[model samples]
Target: MDSNAMATDSTSGPTANETEQDGRVDEHNGPGKVVYEYEDPAYRVFVDTLNYLEPEEIEQVLAAYRFGEKAHQGQTRLSGEPYITHPLAVAGALAEWRMDAPAIIAALLHDVMEDTSVSKAEIAERFGKQVADLVDGLSKLDRIEFQSYQDAQAENFRKMLMAMATDLRIVLIKLADRRHNLQTMAPVRPDKRRRIAHETLEIYAPIATRLGLNNISRQLQDLSFKHIYPMRFRVLTRAVKAVRGNRRELLSKILDGIRSKLQESNIEAGVFGREKSLYSIYHKMVDKHLSFSQVLDIYGFRVIVRDVPTCYLALGALHSRYKPVPGKFKDYIAIPKANGYQSLHTTLIGPYGTPIEIQIRTQSMHHLAEEGIASHWLYKDSEESGADLQVKTHKWLQSLLELQGASGDSSEFLEHVKVDLFPDEVYVFTPKGKILALPRGATVIDFAYAVHTDIGHRCVAARIDHELIPLSAELNNGNQVEIITAPHANPNPAWLNYVKTSRARSKIRQFLKAIQQDSSSALGENMLNQELQALGVVPSEIPAAVWERVIRDSGKKSRREILTDIGLGRSLAAVFARRLVANDEVPQNEVSESKPLVIRGTEGMAVQLAPCCQPIPGDPIVGLLRNGQGLRIHTHACQATRKSRTTEPQNWINVEWEPDPDQCFDVRIRVTAKKVRGLLGRVATGISQAGANIEHVNMDGKKPGLFIDLHFLVQVSGRPHLAALMRSLRRIPDVVRIVREQE
Candidate 1:
């Protein structure tokens, strides 16, 4: 019988003594009493998978199935099958992994709460709390209104992850649910099918891989591939089958060789021929730009051994028989994958110079690789075999909580989760010899964040293999990294361009947002106070009622929000100040102009020196109140703002530089120098001698015949320092002309 078909077609009726019964009758049913006589074909087919469970446990699962069947009596799927069949199939899938009774029960009723009138309390009363919670976690947040489909999807994902964090079985059941959906997605519309396929291929497949459910992950990918690109999938499937047929003799020979070698070494193992999934084949072909022939590792062998030590012994035997390909061997047994998958992988040159891939691992490791967290019944507290796998899975789940807390919204949280799901890990080391596995292309900042969020926040530079490297440097396998942090150092916004890990990106964003809010609030308060003082009013003397009236009229939640809005330039500070004093019965004089705000270059996100002019201290400047973006400062003669100043006069605010600024400001300078050897070096040396650092250099080579125009973005303290640097550059004989550049 087809495994997926839930005995939907009736057969001969049950007979006396059960000799020729259509379905297997439970021996547990008392004499003259039949709890379930296979009347429900779905239940009959599903019962066959419960052989591993005790009689009472199977009865409980059957009970849940009956409840779901009754609840979904009138409902049918897109496939036109009774809705109960769907849950039964999901439960059967989980049962293949030997999941506990509660998980199976949850699977059997995963959709009741969402599609029917059954409540969580009712399910809890019927089955139990654990099963009810799993079903709830697997349910979608459809009833809760959201602005868009993306919002609803992100919220549902977030909710599911939170539930998974508490009990990992939720993810297992959810994966099974998704798997069954993909299998029966033909009846779904084409547009919806494509969307679901894309989502499954992008998200659920990677998630399954992360959990080390290699078998299920492959199935999900292949099913998604079939729906998303039916033509490619069909073409690829035919091609792979044809190739397999042509190489059947070669495959048998390789399998025989592996078996003989393992037996000769007395390594007692099971060697099986493995074929790459169609989706994997297509992925490899597209990713590597390879043709069918170029994908040499499409056919491989998996050697399952009795224990860890024998795995290596069998690998040696296989290598002794065939010439091992150079640099094609990996010892995952020593340092397992982040998902706790352990295998010794090697490639050998088979007959006719074709490459043969071989993976040798213990039977236990193989089981874990196939079933992932579901391989061991986590409900049982004392499963020592899966202890390491549980720990790794737990750590990943815990990070979801952290990401959820740090994220500003559901969509942002979903993006972070996606970033973490596709981890092609590269293992590195800490200074103290502790091994850390990070996603491929992860940088030093990612490492610091992986170590701890606080470390990532304060990280400045790193020493990789005892040599100082930039924090954005990509770490490699086996590199020992030591983070160099400073108490005063802050996360640079530019780090977002290179940090690969989600934790680092989220933490950096979180920190920058916090500092921005603080700075904007302070700036808003200062601006308001200055404006009030110009009107001869003291800010402190404003009564509570007056402040409340202004806040209410502004449509803001509290005083701090108003201040933040004002500081962010979303609201004019003068308008709010006038409103605050409007209700106050204070003696007021003609409102004189407010004193100019000082530009100290230390206001963090609240004050952004416009890149167009790159204003330095001592340069006359004006602040443009950009809505929601805080004050953008520009030099008085900046060409970029010249049109804006006249067109939007309300946005321009009076601003002046402080007498002494604590930080350097970037200024651009254009230098026309003779195109001669070492001319650029001499100019750089002159600028360095003048106490300025060149942040960037750009050469305008459009019409250069003998002279080259070099634009240098240099950091200087103030105008005097910039002038001195220009003077030093002018002393160079090759320098034709030098001018401070501005838009």
Candidate 2:
């Protein structure tokens, strides 16, 4: 049966063996004796979870469960079990993590909106708005049809994350939901299992890690690995078990040694050994190109102390006893990660010359390390600690919202978030000594955006450690960076090449999009004006009703939009003008005596001269009207223009340079000169004297000391100015020949 149909059926009534009582199932014998079954695993787990909550909180959770149970009454899972069991399992996982009553309750009702007829408003009235919002966030929109399964998944993830940003509890509930789903995916189809498992691995697991829920993240990874690569998982699991059996004595010795040393040092601590997860072990093997036997350090130790000071004492004692592996120690306690994980990590040469990793942290730190943002609830009663964590998480969420605002589409937003999910990071400092952690390989542009959007948009250069550096310079740990900004400066498209942060990329893309639209709008206006002139009618003389009709007919919003479409090459200005004048709304008057379209190099991005022939003033030029790209002016002699003229003569329009154009255009010239030390210098000096700037110089020395080919990219006002420069260069004694390079 279809899952949705099963879910709908489940909401009808209780099963044959059960009777409804106060929205719950009560077992009844033939003689009217009522029996409540407490032996079920789901019931037992829920009861166990209640032990961690207060009496009132427990009642609230139970109330939500009863409501959810009634809503999902007749629903059966793919495993043929009652559908309510799924939410109970999710709540059980969250309860295991000691989440607050609201979180647990939300988990129980997370699927109500998706599977049942319950509305968010109803849930809110029964529970609070917070719980309803969390449920709604976890619920999927079944009505929207996406282009592909991948698109649907990406969009769903995007929605979940946006909701998560508002209240982190949504993601906590989502992770719990995913964990339970993966745990019970045995009966699912292979293809479905693989797709869900891959998603769990790629999206959910990384988010769990980023949020610092290590236990959930690790479990998700192993479960995903099992489904995505079952053979490898089985092989690695067996290998780990065999190794554990062989190294039992060695692990015992190492644990005993650490415990003994901590006792001797008068440091009170709890020491235990833990084998790495199968997926992690496999990851290490693949990442390091090692065989199963070669992947050591699979077993690690965790030393939990009473407080921060004692954590250091315990670490020192352990290191003094074991041979420390050089460069394998990290003081995360000194510089906590963005997720607020604080621990000291060290690797040591243990018994049998094997390597073992160790983690040291206080009891509270250990809790935080395991739970991450969820620890906020663990210390919710403490205003200082919980509020600080909440604030940090909220700040990160706010940044995500900013990215969402800047992103052009859902896919782009998801792509940016994926880039932000990378765990590796480098901590850099500002000029004020404030440290800002960024992803590894993040450049100065990413740093600037991390500071502020305006600063990033205006940034032109940077100084790392008091040394001026390029904006693309990769930042390093502890380097103090100072961004140099100009008020009028804007983001360059080239900045996208090296920016590592999503925020930087999004902001740059947004700026470029805005600029493109503005330029296209302006170009569209010009093109339409030229078309109107060609039609022997003035724009002002065209009836407003005709423009309105054209706008309506073209499905554009307004005159400006139509023009922008024309400018962007989405539509032709001539066609639009023909539509406007179809009924002879404006009478023709001797071709309107229109002046030639003027060319000024200062058109910025709105008008571009084709690079093929590099048309300058005094060069015979024609404008090619392109869709979405405005007008592209080309010289008559350009081969590209000649080819396009034959095929698309209608796109061509008359264009001429403005008298005495003020801006310079680039032109290339080739010179063959005697290969000598002063030959290039003399040619450059001659060009400079003729009032032209050499933008580039390419020299070929295949026949050294005999003859050399020189290619110069020089800026000139017009063909006359270029000819003057070429004549000046030709007079040089080392010059054998000089000629303008043609397309």
Candidate 3:
């Protein structure tokens, strides 16, 4: 802590109203001097911290101090102090949290590697791997370039998450670093301060809360609020101050009464008052649309005890002393927060009808609350039970690793990280009592997905505590969710709309894309086979291996790939299919004129159907296999098919869907719809009248409140002719833009 941080405020110190001007002299050219100074006298409190650490630790500390001082020798901070002061302040904050020797040492040297010629290996050798690793894990994301502030902000947030997942302490140091920076943010440019403070409020504070660093979280939230929304923060701050003034005497009486009651009960506890951060109060006002005074429980107290049992005793005593706010009590000791914080919380009407919140925890838990995971290292000796949360916390870290496998691309990996790294969680339970923590707003499907990939793939239904709930039902704290799965079940695309967990969302998307690819590939292969038959090329002659090689050379893999290509019109399936089959003695005959055919088949075959020609069951159909897509079935009379026969005739195929298609195929329909009320309903009614199902409907906005162009992707059996369907659609009143799917 530099043994000088805990300085007291003095009249000799620069007043808050005074400003420090920038000193940009060429200090590096000569002996660099302390470019600026600080007035945060609170740092002086850490002189005692030096007592517990050994002399070797002191060496590391001094080395970092000197190294950072020289590296930033010419640098003046936003507050116009020597840049070393910031690092000193950050180190002091970490010391106050009672972090161990290495963490404190790391804090001292945190920015040295980022801003100076000092090498990472140098820090590693001087300070040990632990401290160096922590420093290395800390981000230099700020020093990178981005297209826009938003882009930079997003990337930085992601980098921060990755860094934290790698080592939780980096973020701890970062929070400390951020707190000190924010404390002196006033000297930063107005815009820069706003951005920094807004980010701190939105993300860092929330992270601290999750970690149970209550004091630090409160300070961060308050500071960020002041900068992000000055008016609101000021208004709430003043209002809270007024309320505190009015309740001071009452709260005093209440605390005394409670203390006396506890003493009478022979229970000794440390009780401290807590005031809600201005940002929290303001957020409640804005989010719930409540007036400033409506935010109750803004004033609270914490009761720290010596043992777990004592915490409960304190809670009972608190309840006995005050009328506890109904439904406001929570026993986190049984169901700890995702970040491993455990406590007993109760809101009560304290003396004089003032609503107050009281939190009760053991001394160990209190340390955890104030110091977070870092306390694991700081006071681990005091917690003799072993690190209970190490495995669970590591599991959380492992799940974050699952995000690392989400995509190979850096940007995409970063995107998925954002989704998986949300610090806030809604802890729920499995039917058999296993706890699962998911992000807030996660649904039953997400819960199902979280249980297992197979469960997600086969999820058919869900029951919350033996009662059926919508798959989209949002699970709450402590919900017991049991997923129901069946072999044939698959995730519906609709799940995408409600799934909150990134894992679930990503899996669903991956599965759907795979399905689309397979379907398109199937259509492509079918067309290719038909084209091969037309060319008198036998499928039996060409070995699948040879065909694989040819397709691979073409940069397409698998029969599915070839089919998908044909369907998409990127490549003719007939050309490739015939080229493969004709590898033997088989010879292709000249092309024969034929109309397109629309065929119903029990098999998956669709006689080289061209979506452009929309060959009907009765039409003379010819197939064109796209590059590696679906087989495009085209009518004999189709202009595109005829053009292919001359320009790319190998695409022509003699093919057919089986005698009866078990399912309807997708067909495009464009309808000019009236803008009047119920017009869309009428259109839907018409499609039903023709015994067709509208699989997809997209409607454009109306221009003059009179009409709209509606595109419907319909599924229909071979029972309807294309010409007849078009005629029926055209006959409908108010139908002007009706067209078959076309170029």
Each candidate's TM vs. the true structure? 0.90, 0.89, 0.71
For each candidate in turn, give its C-alpha RMSD to the true structure in angstroms: 5.4, 4.3, 10.6
lDDT of each: 0.83, 0.81, 0.69
lDDT of 3 by residue, 1-743 (tens): 11112222211212223233322112454332223232345333443355455544544454555555555666666445666787877888777666777788778777766666566777776667888888777646656788876776666666666767777777788889888877877766678778788777667777777665667888998888788778877777678889999878877887788788889889988778888777777777788998876787777888888888888888888788889889888888888877678899888887667787888988888777776666666686436422655555566666656665654444555555456546367888887889887888899988988899889989888888789887889988878899888998877889988988778877887776666666555555555555665565545655767777777778865666666666556776556865575454444456544323333532233223456755545555666644534355666677755556888765454665556556666678788867777778777877877777788898887456777988888777653554556666766787776776654
Clash count, one per candidate: 0, 8, 61
Q: Which segments of model 3 are wrong by more than 4 Å?
A: 1-48, 98-102, 117-132, 141-147, 381-386, 407-427, 476-479, 513-659, 665-716, 720-743
Global Cα lDDT for candidate 2: 0.81
> For model 2, how does the per-residue alpha-carbon lDDT over 1-743 read when each residue is reduced to its tens digit?
12212453635222223333332222332222223344576675566556666655765676687777888887888788888888888888788768888888889888878877778888887789888888888887676998987778777888989999877888988888888888888888888889888888888898888877888899999999998998998888888889999999999999999999999999888999998999989888889999988988889999998877887888888889989999898888888888777899999988878898999987777777777777766654333444555676787788789888998778898899888887499999988888898999999999999999899999999999999999999988789999999999999989999999998999999988888778878777877788788778777888888888878888889987887788777887779878877866776666765566776855756688888888888888888877656678888888877778999987777778888988889988999988778788888899999999999998886755688899999999898998898888878888999978868
Stretches of model 2 off by over 4 angstroms after superposition: 1-39, 51-60, 100-102, 125-128, 351-353, 379-386, 535-559, 578-596, 641-644, 648-652, 703-705
Report clash pairs, candidate 2. 10-74, 10-75, 568-627, 568-628, 568-629, 569-627, 569-628, 570-628
The lDDT of model 3 is 0.69
Top-down TM-score ranking: 1, 2, 3
TM-score between model 1 and native: 0.90
